[model samples]
Each structure stands twice: as structure tokens, then as C-alpha cells.
Target: MAATARSTTPEDITSPVRELVIPDPSSSVRWHEHDWPHPLARWHYHPEVEVHLIRESSGTVMAGDWAGPFGPGHLSLMGSFLPHNWISHRDDSAVVRNRDAVLQFDQERFFAAAGTLPELEALRPLLEAAARGIEFTGRTAVQGAAAMEAVNGTFGLRRLATVAELLAVLAESPESERRYLDSRGGTYRLDASEAEVFNRALGYITEHLEGRMLVPEVAEAVGLSRDAFSRLFAKATGVGFNRTVTRMRLTEACRLLRGTDLPVSDICYRVGFTNLSNFNRHFRATTGTTPSRYRRIDQL
Candidate 1:
């Protein structure tokens, strides 16, 4: 499937599509609250570089081609325009919250601070490569998570020190330990028109994932023909309409399997899978493990 088109509106185009805006990037690192009552399944991006630490939640993490299950101890660095989201599958009553410490500064600020500083200048390539996405798997996450937490709480000079420390730690870490996502390409940004359409479609899909989600329905919602919408959606999201919907449903199913005590059949129906056999097949295909096995592993 092709990816969705870029946004074209001024507000949607100029500003990042985030729920909370962090206006100050020069002072202290900004912390945002992402505690939605229900699971979030929307595909969105921002202009800032994101450092996320998964504390006590599990979900499907989508970042370009890197789509899979992620649980506690997972940390990632997402550059501007790289779309991502954590779709929680836990029951609505269960608290599925994410603790994020984000720093949003442009290339200009980075260069202005580090260009003349010999120590920081050496890490420029690592920062540039992070424009794609970076996932830390081992000790880097442990160290980075602490730094993120400290920066979130500190202020003034201490906060700046923490932020600098976080970047330096991430930059100096061995490349072999950092898992890069979508490193082979340049960064991508959406125009106003495309961003609006894509966000609307994504919102609709998240709300109606438990029901029949047809291509025509999505196209009509976006004021396009089925064929035209299909091409555009594929182009924008890098996945076809059917595939995207299926992935969304499977993501929800994984959440339920890990965070809820619901039975397999119940989970299938809850996530919009009417056919039990088909659900089993697709779930295994997408996750590379059966629902029962996934649940067991997560429990362990």
C-alpha cells in the first residue's frame, strides 16, 4: 500500500500534530501527559526528537517499517516527521499510561550549541542518523530512562545539565547497541491537506476498529472515491487500507492478550474479528506467535 499524502493546512502544517504543545525548548525539557482513558491508535508525527521510555505498559509500536510488540524497558528516539503511536489493548478500566520526557529543538539550536564545542560536535552524525528513529535495547535504555526522568523533574541550570547529559550518553553509546528504525531514507513531513485527511482517517479507524471497516466507508469519510482513497492512504501510511486496518485490529488484540484476562475468542470479537479461525491465523502471522503463547511470554 502507498503512504498517505501530507497535510496542507497552516495550523496542521506548521505545528506538530500532538495533543500537548511544548512551547519552551530552551529552558528545561518539557514533559507531556499521555494518559488516555482508552487505548490510542492514531498515526501522528511531530517536529521534535522524542525520547520515550515504556515503564509498565505493552502495545504495538509503529515507526515506519518497525512494527511489533513492545513492553516495559523499551526506549526509542524518534526524529521529526517520523510517525508513531502506542495502541493500548488493555481494558478501558485498566490504567495504560506512558511516561515521556521529550526535547524539541531544531537543527539550528543543536548547531548553535554544539558547533563550536569540540566535545558535542563529534556526535553530529549520530544526531543526524536519529532523524530516522533510534531504539535502545539494553543498558542504553536503563541509563537514558534515568536521565529522562531526572530531566523531567529538574529545572534551570540543572535541567540543562540533565538534558545535555542525556544527549551525550545517547550519542556516545556504541552504535552496535542502538537499534535504528528506517535508517535508509530521509525524513518525511506531511503537508496541511494530507495531514488533515490522514489524521481524520486515523481517528475514524481507531473509533471503529471493533466493527466492519470498509474501504468505501473510509473513502466517503474523507470525501474521496474508494480507489483514490486507497492509493492515498497506502502512500501516506506505507500500508494498504485493509492491511492497516488489520494491523490496527491485531495491535488491539495483542494489548488485550497482555493486559487483560479475556479469553481468546472474546478478544477476537472485541477487536472486530468475527471469524475465530481467521483471527487466529492473522494474529499469528502478524505477531509470529499464537495469542496463548504471547500471553504466556508476557506473563513471564
Candidate 2:
């Protein structure tokens, strides 16, 4: 049977479109709230660092090659040029007001200020990590969202202070409360063809994460020789192809463990691991806890 064609209209969201974000003349950062279905609500990338807060709605949030669920209080930071978007599941005529709160500032300006202010320099590592995008969860998300609201309600120095507070919350988040959103660092420039190839690779990884995945086959499928594909994949994603696959499988396993009642052993094989011991070991190494214990803590 032939697959049904997916139709798209002008309102359809597509990713990585270059966007021009202009801050207000009097403000150093752009802080604004906008409704869903607005012109700016699309998959786009800009040169400014972004702090984003979801005020309402549930949807899939995409950053680079990562896509996952998001809802109210979803807070994240993306460094310059990271492609991102949130697609809310809603009716065609739905209109959601104040669905997103966004703050964008020039990275070079911030870095220049940091060069003079020693205190601001302390956040260097957090800004660096934002190159791959960062998602906050648990208490970090709560605090970050509150800070964003404060930013919304203030102006001048107070707004900037609240922005700093939000960044501090993200920078100090425990590893268990944050997730890096992309394997690909956003610094690498990919032309349209390269971006398409990389997106296809990511799509394949998403679809096959629950099964055995091999590099050679994936390379051939993407129409590159194994060695060439290895170089491009590593350059574009900052990780080896096999390691990326392993990470994705482990991430999926974590989701299942948190959101479903599946037995740990069952989730092990279900996420493409051939052995339960190996699964447990990798999960522990990556997440700093055994799968069963991770679930227990999540439940608590």
C-alpha cells in the first residue's frame, strides 16, 4: 500500500529558516510574549542567544535534531543560531494568547560585558552548553519559569536582573534536572543540502532507536560512504554516529521508564539493548542512576 501524502499549507512549520530578530532600541535584550499561530511561530534560527518559556499549551519542542514533549513551564536556553521551534497540537482555528515568553540578546555583547565584569564571566560554561540547547526540568524549570514571568512584568534594570536570575537557575541546575537538547552543536554552519541530509539522518535515528542500528547501513541510506558519512556526522553533530544512537536509545528508555509501567528488563530490550546488564550499566553511566532507581526517584 502506498503511504498517504502529507499535505502542507502556508501555515505549515518548517525548520532552520533564518530569522531576523530585532531588539527594541532602548533595551539590550528583546523580551516579548506572543500568541500561537503568529507569524514568528515557526521553526527558525537567529544569531541571538534565547531564553524561552512556554506559558501554555502542550506540544513537541524541537531543537536541532532533538524533538520531545513540552507543556506549560517548559523552559530552555539556546545559543546563537540553534534551530528551534514548538509545534502545539491544536485545532486549525485555535488561537492561544501569550503562549510563549522569549528573551534574546546578542551573544557578542554579552561576552564583551563578561570580559569586563568578572561575575558575569562565571556563566561562561552555561552559555557554552547552550550551543547545543538546554532544557530545564523539575525545580529548575519552576524557578526559571518564575524568573521569566518576573522579566515579563518588569523593565529596565529590574528586567535585566531577572534575566540574570533565570540564567543562574539554569547554570546551577543539577545534572538530574537538566537535559542537553542536541548532539549537534549549533556553531557548525550547514548549507541547505547538508541540513537536509542531517535532518534525514536524525529522522532515521528517531524511527529506528528501538532496534539495532548500524553506521554503514545508515551511511548508505543517506547516500554517503561510511568514512565520508562518519566525518560529516561527527562534524555536524559533535559525536560519533554509534554513540549518538546509543544516547538516543538510552533517552527513549528513560522516557518509557518515567511515563510507563513497563518492567526495567522489558524496557532494556525494547530500547535496542541486547543484554539487561549492559543496559543497566549504560543507563547508570549516562544518567548516574540505575533504571529502576531512576524511575523510583521520578515517582517520588
Candidate 3:
């Protein structure tokens, strides 16, 4: 439970990332759980700014236009309106699980706390720029992870100090190392038609994940050309069509591994992969561990 911050079942929030209330907003420091039975790779946005410290999981962490394989000690700060998701392979025990500690607060609350402080004010731009998403690597991520972990049990001024230190570390992160997820004004609105297209494509992909999925086939299902669908899919979801489909398949693979008693080869075929080698390769690359090892760890 210390991994995820929420107390409710994962079904409560349809979104991949759910909001967890920090008790005493003023002193809210807690871990939330995000063990959804279903895998999520959809594109959605939130109003709160989020800072995530990913521990012991590996996957494609997508935010706006940025996407990358996340490893242990990975950290990211995403501003409001940035759509993102983490897609990981499942453990062999049939449980698709990963733990992340998220700290979220409103922009207004952040500015109000720093309005009078010139030093803090200087970091506002960085925060604003992160409206898309900012991934930290190397020393900054490691240092930030330590600083954030310090806030886990802190209270009163001490907790606030940890939060400030975390933000300061984020502010000082190298701009070159920080990748943005979306370009300015590139956010897409999901209307009925777009939603229909997305849902249809997603449904079809999920249903046939064990087989080859062609862009043109998906496009035809939604009445769009391959090129048009690809562009729209990326624009609307902040990820490409192939990547989205791969993420979906991988997500399901994780679910079966943790929730079912099926063999790894069976799971690979069930998730639409024709070859076990490719599945294993992708699983290891995405989760940073073999399916069997992941299952073993989760079981313990």
C-alpha cells in the first residue's frame, strides 16, 4: 500500500492514474496503490501536477510527446494537462503490478506557497515548462529519489522542507537531459468521433493482440487512412499507433502473468505474440526483468 497512495479499489478511477487525497493537504505525505486488474494505455490528462518516483519497475513511461523505458530510481515531474501512462510486462504469477509514489498538488497551491520567495519564484518557469512532462535521469533522478523518500515520514515544517528540496533538485536538473512530452499547443481534444475511433482501434487491438496488427486494418475499422490514423492517434494520445498497440499487448501480458496460471508461452500467444522469443525480449526490455523473475519477486 505504501507504493500507491489511494485506499480504494483500482476500478474506481477509469483513468490509468488515480487521484489520492493527501491527508491534511498541508501535511499530506502518503503512498498510494495502483494495482488495477486491467491494463491501461489510454491517453488522458489530469489537473494536478504529479511527481513520480518509480522503483523496481521498468516500462515505457509516456507523457505528452515524450516516452522512454523507465528503470529503478526513475523520476518525472508532469504538469497539469499532460497525458501519460506507464505500461509494464506482467509477472509470471499472473499479476500485472508495479509500484510508484506520486506527489500531486494544484498549481495554485504551489505558487501560493512560493509567491513571496524570489528564489523559489525563479524556478516557476521550469515548473511551467514541465506542463508537458520532464524526465530526470542520472544523478538528478537518484538525488531526487533520495530527497523525495526523505519526505515519506516527515511532518510539519520538515515535510515542507523535503518538498521544497525536491522541487529545487528538479529545478536544477539539466535542461538537455529533460525531455518534453508534447509540443506547445499540441494537445488534442477527444470528441465523439475521435473517441469512437480510439475505442474501436483499442478494442480491436486488445482483442487481437496475439496476431499482427496492421495500421491500415485499424484505420479501416475507424474509417480513416493509415497515415491519417497514425497522425491523429499520436496527436490525440501522445503516442504512436504501434507503440500504443505494443503497450496494450504488453499490459495484457502482465495481467495474465500475475492473474492466471497460464504458461509463459501460452501467455505470449494469448497476447498475440506468435513467438516466445520476441515476447521474452520485449518483456525483459519493458520491465527490466524476465517474466519468471518478476513473478517470483511479486510472490515473495
Candidate 4:
């Protein structure tokens, strides 16, 4: 259920990308299953707490700043606004059916209800720890995954009970049987109204990774003035726009360096860094090593 870290990118507390999840108005929880290439399978965070189980496929999972491999039975709980994505390695034409089971609920409301139902209080700490993202192991993983699946087949009180059961299983997991993914830090602060704007801006950045990305250009693309975009971007991402772009480029550079035989200079430009010296400097600062050293160590 656990895999080794695939990238040396130091764990950051938050990411700028956000996913707006709208739960059914009738129910407190949203449970569903989807395929590998579904529209929801991307790097984004939401305000709801999520219990996610991977039913199939092997891929690199990026939760916050933690990147690692995951396969079937991979279960994790990510708290509000913690960016996460499962990047499955498959042929472009391949399709994996029902590859993910996900349950998302408003933990704040659950906590409020716990005041009247004292029995629910025991789960408070587990929900708090989930802000850093928790990966269950051994028996916890097995039972949590089962309980998550059970939520899909029930309705009304039965479905709520199943969700509680899943939380209890995860809450009871020993420290040794669970791994916290993100480092201690702040999470993305985004308003629901601005989610679409940020999503469009982030997508544009991803598409143009091979070229220079300007604040005014991206602002125009997202229908915001340059100054307005700058302020909002800093508030939502906890950093300046340029820094975010640099970090993203460095991430892509690391991938190319580790997985391909591309030259370091070529990688610098490919990831939108016009200066090799600047790329090398930033890589060393973020990863604590030079590009050649990182590739050599990772390859071995």
C-alpha cells in the first residue's frame, strides 16, 4: 500500500491548484467511483475532507509536495485545500475502468454534530491530522478501503454509518501504520467564486511550461487585471506568482532529469528557464543538489 518517494521536491504545506467539489444537497457526504482518465483525476484541492482509494493502476501520486508511487488499495485522507493528484502511467489510449473510489464530506459539520453525539468526539484528532494528509498501512489500509467501498452500496443512515466506520478505522490506526504526507505549514486559501479563475490560470501555466509565462498574459487569459491577479494569486498560493512558476518548472525539470537522457541545458529551456545558470542555482537551492548529481543518484 506504500511506495518510496519518487521526487526529492521538499514537502510544501500548500499548492495553488484548487478543485471545487459540490456535494449533493440532500446528503452530507458524496461517494462515487470513476475511471483513470476521468475529468476529476488532476492536481487540485477542495474544501471537503476526502477519503480516496485506488482500485487499480500504478502511478506517481502528488499530494501537497509529497510525490510517490501508488497502486491498488492505496488509501489516503486529505483535508481541506490540500492539493493532490494521482498520475497513472499508462498508454495514452488505455482506459482503466472504476479505478478510484472517493468519499468527500464536510468535516466541519461532522465536528459540529459531534457536540451532541459525544461518541463522535474520538474522531476529532484524526480529522485534524488529516490536514497533513494520512496514508494508512497494513490492516488499516485493508479495512479502510473496504469501508469506503461499502459507502457506495448503501443509502440514508446506512451510508453515514459506513463513513463513520471508515473514519474510525483510520483513527484507530497506530502511528507506525500511518504516514503523514505534507509538512507542517499553511494550506491554500481560495474563495469558491475564484476557483474557476485559478483553475484556468493553472491549466494555462501547465500548457505553456516550455515558454515564458507573464503575469499580464496569464491575467488577460483568466479575465483579471494584472494587479488583481497578483494579489489573488499570492493569497491563494501563499507565495508570489514568479516563485510558483519557478517551483513548477523545477518539478518538471526533475521529472525529465530522472526519467530521460535529456541534457541539463535542454531541460532548463524545456521547462521554461531561459538561463541554465539560473535553473542550476534554483535546483540546488530547492533540492540541495545539482542537476547532474540528482539525476545520477536517482538513476542508481
Top of the candidates by TM-score: 1
lDDT of 4 by residue, 217-283 (tens): 9999889999999987776555668877787778777767766788899889988998999999999
- For model 3, state the Cα shift of residue 141 in Å: 0.8
lDDT by residue for model 1 (1-300), tens: 221111112221222334333567556346544553322234566666667776765666767645566777777877766777654435434654553335555544566767576666865776687766788867788898787777766778888788788887788788777877653335445565665676677666766778898989988987888888887776666656887788778877877777678888988997899999999999888778999999899899
Considering lDDT, where higher is better, how would the candidates rank from best to worst?
Answer: 4, 2, 1, 3
TM for every model, in the order presented, reads 0.73, 0.67, 0.62, 0.65
Q: What is the C-alpha lDDT of each candidate?
A: 0.67, 0.76, 0.65, 0.78
Task: Show how many residue pairs clash in every candidate, following the order shown.
Answer: 22, 0, 23, 0
lDDT of 1 at 96: 48
Candidate 4 stretches greater than 4 Å from native: 1-29, 36-47, 54-75, 81-99, 112-119, 132-193, 288-300
Instruction: Please identify model 1 stretches exceeding 4 Å from their true place.
Output: 1-43, 53-61, 65-74, 86-100, 111-113, 172-185, 274-281
Give the 10-residue window scoring lowest on summed lDDT in candidate 1.
Answer: 3-12
Instruction: Write model 2 residue lDDT over 74-125, tens digit each, in one string.
Output: 9999888887777665655677799999988887877789878878886888
RMSD of 3: 8.0
When 2 and 3 are scored with lDDT, the better candidate is: 2
Deviation from native of the Cα of residue 226 in model 4, angstroms: 1.9
Kindly list the per-residue Cα lDDT of model 3 for residues 25-108, writing each as its tens digit.
Answer: 555434343442333334455666778877664545666645455656878887776766664433334443546667766766
Candidates 2 and 3, the one with greater TM-score? 2
Q: Quick one: ranking by TM-score, best first?
A: 1, 2, 4, 3
